[model samples]
Target chain A: MSELLLQKKHSSYYYVKSKLSTGLPLFAAIFLVLLIALLLLHFIWHGAPGITWAFLTEAPRNNNTEGGIFPAIYGTVFLVFIMSLLGVPIGTATAIYLSEYARQQSFFSRSVRFGVNTLAGVPSIVFGLFGVGFFVQFIGKGIDTAAQTTIWSKPSLIWAAATLSVLTLPVVIVAVEEALRNVPQDLREASLALGATKWQTIWRVVLPNSLTGILTGTILAIGRGAGEVAPVIFVGAVYSLPQLPDSLADQFMHMGYHIYVLATQSPNAADALPLQYASTLVLLILAFSLNLTAAYIRLRIRRSHK
Target chain B: MSSNSTLYKKSKFRPFEAIIEWIIRLTASFSIIIIFLIFIFIFKEAGGLIFGTAKELKPKKAVSEKVQDKSEEKVKPEIYNPETGEIVKIVEVKKLVKAKETESQSIWANLFSDTWQPVGKKPKYGIQPLLIGTFKVTLVSLLFATPLSILAAIYCAFFAKAWIRDIIKPTVEVLAGFPSVVLGFFCLVTVVQGVYSTTQFLQPLCTNIADIISWILPFSDRWIHSALTISDFHYSAVVGGIGLGLAVIPIIFTISEDALSAVPNSYREASLALGATESETAFKVMLPAALPGVVAAILLGIGRAFGETMIALMATGNAALFSWNIFHPVRTLAATIGSETGEVQWGSLHYNILFFLGILLFLVSFIINALTELFVKKYLSKKFQGA
Candidate 1:
């Protein structure tokens, strides 16, 4: 080393002190270790089963030897569909109201944000309670009496869907708001300068720009709706109903709750094992894919906008 | 032209803008309507158990009273088999027994019993055991998880290097992706097995170790080694604590990390420039600054751990002991409510009890969340002011 450089480095206490500021590696080490451990456990415990069309379509059997999670998979898909239909537009509109139109810093708007945040933090069980009390009972009335087509035939699915939608709506609104906020204010001003009405500016410019983010958030909310077991169990989920719901009113089974029950309550070791893992895999895949799709859209939009 | 426009605008705000403002204001106000509706529905569903049920439950209560009265009855019934006939008539003996039996069902009356025998001839739905179990598991979990998460956050926020921070931030969040069922499975298949065995092996070893330590310290051998028994550590509060802890670790880590990072860098720099070490700056300076948010994280973490269903359902043995012993089995409200949903008929007392459990859960987490929000709001308000 050069004598001048060597002297300066040795003379300064800053060099020694700078080395002490390393917490990042520690954090990374812990995180990676935990993730790897969890993944390894998941893969190791959940053995790959031979997936067949028969396995995916058949019902659980009288004996604990052969059955697929067809009913559960069917139920989860229906749930995600309902949650998306109910949550998407309402959440998008709410986000638009918060970000584009409203001065959310105002007291009224601030309180609204507070409510949304509180709702977000409320436990899943509380949502279950609400689902049971509201959807299954109060709202179940008109739909419950169909009596012909579904196990529940009349009421449960719509109510559960509505409840799940509201439960996840806050997250959608927040994500959508963030996405909308990411739209540069200059774009809005430019539109206004061209004599566009506020609604026209928002619809033509702000919303189109934010669509990617809004979709991502909406999908994320759906993923949450999919994995949930607690509230839906109370509001819906009949015990191991053998058949799939032919219609909305048809009573349903669920993957998450099924896994919970099979693993905890049922003693069908070999039979339920593969089915549980497969069902879990299906639910995880659904959640992951939805999240990934939304994330991909957001990334694409962001790149173009940038 | 600008002055004319300004004068026109100053004379009165535009009616269209005013209307738009009102619309915006109304949308914000709508959340209140949402909360109210939620409360109304939850209370109504839960309300059936409280005010609406008199037939099934009330008759059971009367039956129980008759049973109790019979147990204390002084007189006996005379036998009546005067003729060999198809009709079988027996005279009642103890009025008290009949009164108690008429008053309530044993199963229904003992809903608060520490033991849960849901499938017995005299089915019991004693949720007290489950509630106690829930409490033990939750308390243990929060105890285990809260500290580690907060510490991890603090270290990451103030002390970690660049590459480590980047990796840790997202990596820690992976916990969020691990579904609850997966976690429950892990606890049941792996963790429970590990704990059960470890408790067995460690009992003698732990007792010896404790005994040895106690000899050096103040306690006696019997107390220390007995503590080491397999029963002491197997399926104990510690296992549930660890599982629950893992479940909520990311939640606490994320929130606390944000709060810690939100503390101004200037303060850390200033404290460090005064010759205090980086550790001192983190411990004495940033932590105190981020205390409120950290507290919020802990409270929310507590709430999460408390309400967590799947983990407790799979891991805890669901024993309903009122005893505060950590080694014994515990039942929680969520788990019992969850497991019973399939078995219990809708509108039954057990079903109502589940709703009641939901009410308890709602009331608790609501308070925790309210406090968390209040703390976070105040913390941020103070934080921004300081900044």
Candidate 2:
């Protein structure tokens, strides 16, 4: 009887140990989910009240402690728009070359892949430095020297957009390539079997199918580009601008930079707290909506393909 | 049928197609060119300092002497006759000799010293404190993020049902979507206050633990005492690290979850068939198989945290303090560049130093990526070869 009791105790102890181990990881996952929820709630709770139509439409007044963030919003939109125009086509073409044309493991393809990976890993601040050194000092100054004008030699919207396009290139390439790879080999084979040329098959069959994916890539790149402030800090972003940018040559305000300046450098930061929260809220909503749309498109593609 | 035959005949020598393909290939190679351009341009800016060719160095002695004379004149107690516009009395100051000692030191000595004051009359461009700050913040962030992410990854990979997985995955992606600046703002506005209070509450408990550890292990007393003491909690490395950890968690989680799920089902079955518990199979068989990927994920996460700028700039107090206390305010390399590079003269020594820090950040991330690539390749080969 005692031996049986001891055996029962041992089994109970093992059962409790197993339960504890599983419980620990589950608790961790729950913790992370709750943390995210709490963060979002905190932002919305404080920031939602400050968000109004006027707040989104008018320019800041009184040393950026009052009024709205209209100029920053405009600049951010313009920045990302230019970035996508420059980045998407090149990224899509590169993705096509990698997925549809280049032989796997070829030296050139491998080198290109390595370059993409390295570019993805590079820090944003270094990108800013590169922008200043290459775009502002080198190319911009080169243009100025040729034109005999000082317009291009300083930080401006064009240089910032160019730098951001470079930064977002890897994101677009990865997304578009994944989308291209999802197009089945049988479809490509069938197109080629019909006596269609390689370019015709790709342009007709592959590109059509991956159009949503390419759109997704562009949206993702835009989302990333809109939110990034470091690369714009030296290239074009200013703390405050009295007027909206008229051209790519003009320096402009950015949402992220505006928030940063308000949080760190405002003369009366406490008084500006509501404006800071409201600005962060707007930026967050923009980024989240863009990311969600891209994710939704990606999910639909995956489901349809399956 | 006649039109189709004509089209086929026309497609036989499609010059446009060949040209388009070549253009596509060239555009694909632009990534490679851009990478080289980034390296060359950044290095070009830093080359002045690295090669000692900056024009600032040529007039260093004259500049230092001018600074010295100005500093001495300010320190001296002098009486001025306003009508005559001349000094009637002057007292010699001893600070002149000490200033001379610092000014005469070699550039390398100043570069490696503990201070990071780059804007003063006699600028000291020491980089040690920034390096230490970056190291401390990265270490704290890794400590906070790695285990939590890994555990969550394990649960999502091996334990969670399909429905739960769907919810958790999207939530993590939302977290990932948060802009770093937003995270920095959150930390500045809310998290620092929360952390400060929490640390203040935990101080006594930590002191008690330190005392017990010192009593239990005499050899570890000094370091443990220093490590556990939370003197001040405002805008510290610990707070900055937590902010950064929030940024890093999603990257580590997604990669690690993919790796863990990629572990074949056969290993799970084999372990289970041997009477191992479900958790046991996950811990022993699946995790070991996915070790390479998990390690690669962690390295990538480290790379992300190491060079993250806005969070470090906003949350870490930007003090450039040389201390091991996790609760002490610290400044990082990227933060220094972000804050100082704006107003600095384009071709100044301070600008070159910031670029030098950029070079350091670039090299570190490059090495991390190369290492991660090596691990991923090794894992892929092993899996395909049925090792």
Measured by DockQ, the strongest candidate is 2
Task: Report clash pairs, candidate 2.
Answer: none
Interface RMSD of each: 5.8, 5.8
lDDT of the candidates, in the order given: 0.70, 0.89
- Write one digit per residue (lDDT tens) for candidate 2, span A12-55: 78779778779978998999999999999989999999999999
Docking class of 2: acceptable
Give the per-residue lDDT of model 2 (tens digit) for B275-341. 7889989888898889998999999999999999999999999998888888899999989998888
Whole-model lDDT, model 1: 0.70
- Each candidate: RMSD: 7.1, 6.3
After superposition, candidate 2 runs with Cα above 4 Å error? A1-16, B1-15, B61-105, B207-228, B384-387
| Alpha carbon lDDT at B110, candidate 2 | 80
Per-residue CA lDDT of model 1 for B193-259, tens digit only, reads: 7777777766777777786788897656566555554465345566777788888888888888998
